[model samples]
Target: MMAISVTQHAHLLASRALGWLHTHRERGALPPGCTAELAEPDTVYKPLGETGLAASLVLREAVAGSTELRLARELLDFGWKQLGGGSMLHERLLRYPMMSDPLETYAHYARCGYRHEPLELLLRHTTSLHSTRAAEVLPNRRLAVANAARISGFDRGEDGDEGPRTGSTGGTDWAGLTAATWLGALPEPWLIDWLTAYSMTHTVFHITDWGRLPERLPDDIVRHVGRWLPVWIDIWAEIGEWDLVAELLIVDNCLPEPLGDAAVWERLAGIQHEDGLMPRDGHPVTGDDQERFAAHHHSTVVAAVAGTLAVSRTLGTR
Candidate 1:
């Protein structure tokens, strides 16, 4: 078998790093400054993480208008059927804490094919994920209503658990960040469908609860979330997923403004070693620095530099 290219190797390493992060989180072994909680056994699983949410928000902001609205409607129709009919894990999905943009939500629902029955069922199922009555109830209810209104308006026939139609159940099976990018790729008509599917799986579990989590979250939720984070990040970076690229850029941009620090840029720049390799760990170096000039010539380092530059330029443009 042909050896993996330097770029591929870098991505592999990055995936490992992300896996480590996820493992640490799931095990409740995060060092500090990170917060995630476990899921409740009785509750459903949703995959919405901060990174995913941020990416979604950015996508929504970047592509807004009638084209997107129409796409959202189409997606909502498909997503509701897939989710509520039990083809997808609807119950385990976590609802967004804050109400999603109303227009976006409506667009998503309009595209989802399920009518009031499944929509209502999804709302109820999602609502039950919360351990406490007061915790996520209101937000869930609101989302349910918003989603219902959107789908209800578009429902043209009897609504029930319609299984996947013939030749309708095949597509790429990208998980984590890879899946996120696919959603980002959809045109306006399909965006909501992708988002609806995404929201169900993009949750970030809190490893520890500081009086904020529901009364009964499963112990493994945090670990699972942490284990998946690094992999997702690596996939996002490797695939040139501009959604995540924009998110990182936004974060880097915001960091400097709030802290009055240019060091953040310098730090990111510094990660490039003199040889061009971007090691998963070790000291930070720049691609052009002389102290490690020889290092820049290495193929692996060069590939890393390319990835770093890609990320940097994306951020710079934003």
Candidate 2:
């Protein structure tokens, strides 16, 4: 049989995966737990919380301007409708947590040209969290907040100094965060477990634009991550950590140049079901529809986003 190129297969997988998501949207799709709560015909409610919604929206942006733009648009519409008063986005804003997800979600939508009053409110809401809740924000989340601010065209001060203050407390120290998060104290990338490693990767991606803008990451940190990325990818892929592997694919793309690991891409593409569900990890779960969807949705969403991004990069070079 003739082999399909990684880009072509990615396109195929993305198309099929998105189709599966759409087909199953009301059934087993939309995170099984949220299906009932999210069944409201007019809006997409993320019962699982902002992360799934964030990933779905990011997937939309990844596929934007491509042949899959229809799916992208559909998701955008669903998400936009959910931003009204008392919606998931709104509720998250009122709580005033230090998490950066709501900011990143809106920023991704903004990058796709869907700006509106509610999104701005969300951004403003996140900006406020910098000062009002500085102590609660962790280093990785601080990077997310900064990136969201950058992408949304909101100034986060020299280091979010403009945020509200709590007496003697200060804002998130951007320089200090950079100094502490990567390399200097953390274990080698290969030695770290998956989730923490993912956070570190996220720190790099947010700060450095996935290596596209290396200046975002210090020279030492960039060199460090770039040097060890291959080993990380090999290790994760061998263990069938499809989600991490796909994320590593993104990390590879953010490098100074594409890493061009067609084999790794193909291995990721190979494991995808014909219907396009990529299991979150090596072990496949079997059960009721909701149970199964909950187990696999995040990884499937990551695959779609990753595939779309890989295709975009491949085409950009060609």
Per lDDT, the best of the predicted structures is 2
User: Tens-digit lDDT track for model 2 on 104-216?
Assistant: 66665565565666646665655654354455666777677666666666544553234532232334455676776754354556568866778877877677543335455
Tens digits of lDDT, candidate 1, 238-265: 5434333222323222221211123222
Clash total of candidate 1: 44
Q: Which parts of model 1 have CA positions greater than 4 angstroms off? A: 1-51, 61-87, 91-121, 128-257, 272-318
Candidate 2 lDDT score relative to the true structure = 0.60
Give each model's whole-structure lDDT. Answer: 0.28, 0.60
In model 2, the Cα lDDT at residue 254 comes to 65
TM-score of each: 0.24, 0.75
**Shift of residue 276 alpha carbon in model 1, Å:** 12
Which residue pairs show collisions in model 2? Answer: 210-254, 211-254
Best by TM-score: 2
